[model samples]
Target: MPLKPGANPYKILHLEKGCTDKEIQKAYRAQCLKWHPDKNLDNKEEAERRFIEAKEAFDFLYDKEKREEYDNREERIRMAQEHHSKRMAEADGKRKKLIEDLEKREKEFSNGGKRSADGSTPMTAAQQAKKKKTDQRNFKEEIEAIRRQLEKEVNEEVKQKATLMKTEREKHQKSQEKLTPRLLLKWKTSEGLDYSEDDIRKLFSTFGIISHISSAIEKKDRRKRILEFESGANAWGAELETGNAPMPEITCEWLQPPVETVKKASDEPVKSTNTGANNLEHMSLDDLEAQIMGGF
Candidate 1:
């Protein structure tokens, strides 16, 4: 679906230049669970918006080519913030040192020193020169302090306005699915144009699009299909307007070497019951894969 309003994750999960592909996916799913609209129905529109945003977030950061672009942009943002902070810190230090210098000079002049070079007591000329220097330094230091404080306030203001502007936008609409992402996929089998739920689940689930237990229900005569979600909550599939499952371009063989040492994530693992984390809202690629592969 086209991203919902207030759905952007520009502020939610941050992706650094060093984030790995795995980390991007993990961060996207985690933030989606927290901000998904279905789970927070009281604010349905906002929730839906966030859901789309999370999807967009996953798309941008997970796609290697696109992720590079996003990482570059994020790095610029961090750099700007860091630069502003550093400037302020330096100004503060300068202001403090100037104040201390002025105080020390005043104490030295008051303590009664030797006479001036011209045979005059060290009072008038030397003290006047010292006082004038101190005054000029104080003026510059105070102005710098004010400028830094203003910059700090400006940065904070910018952040606040950006936040307020986001939440003020309308929530996401599912109708925008016309702009749905094109699923990059190849046939599950070379010989059979059909997909085997077992292997298909293993592969696609590893990627995040869970195939339904119903395999895929299609009324080609009627041009509609109903597919079950891993959540057991049935939704329209094949009907991309609803939410079509996306598959990857590469075959399983091209993915990675086989794993002989896989273990269960028992605590946060997927449970078949409608009562557990396997529900639509919390399902991750791993969770969906296990569900489709018959949890075997």
Candidate 2:
């Protein structure tokens, strides 16, 4: 199935990236059952749409090659977005500083300080208002200019980055999988009450696409919430950015090594161990029966 633009197969299937084939199949089946038209008679249209979406996601991700390409593209896009955000933040800081300096200068002028280098008197209220208006307009213009320049730079860099990624992907087509970073985060408040998943998304959505959020009660009656971002970088970014935010004043920690890795490790085959009967391998049937009965 052809993948829809801007559609994320992992999110559609409710599975994280690097999930095993069996996990994908299980999620697909769950989605199929949940959204089956017969099961959602009252909302058949929406259900059918979701059902088709699930199928498309399954088909696209079931193919190793296609899924790898999709993942690589998503990574490139996320990196570009983070770069752009960082640049814009720097520009905003500079803009704020400029505004502060302007305000300080206006305050100095208002306090009867020399208005000009040539020992000029303080301006009247009318003149001050005019000056303030002009300064504000100039500040706005400067901010707009900075925004345009940053946008241009980001666009050019993103284009170059995409081209570079393509070339690198071709060169390393058969390379081993890279180490996946931790994208799942544990969130909880000091009060031990967790926010709803929708509320959590509203708070952290600006940082990145949230794949899932689950709430649970841990030991000692502590309520815990696990927030999963589609990008590990975004998860880390959210942790850093939310530190000073008044809302969502809760604590967050990246779940180390990611959940998918833990699942995969647990799924590995263990070495076979000898049974208790192996101790009596040398005994005859009658002797083994006698020994087993005695042991019992």
In order, candidate lDDTs are: 0.45, 0.61
Candidate 1 similarity to native, TM-score: 0.38
For candidate 2, write residues 209-295 as lDDT tens digits. 666665443444334455555533223345443433443355554432221221125785221111111223223334433433343
TM-score between model 2 and native: 0.44
lDDT of 1 by residue, 84-186 (tens): 7786787788778777877767665664666645776666756667786877777777877688787778778689657744543321112122121112122
| True lDDT of residue 285, candidate 2 | 36
TM-scores for every candidate against the unseen true structure: 0.38, 0.44
lDDT of 1: 0.45
Model 2: lDDT equals 0.61
The prediction achieving the highest lDDT against the true structure is 2
Best by TM-score: 2
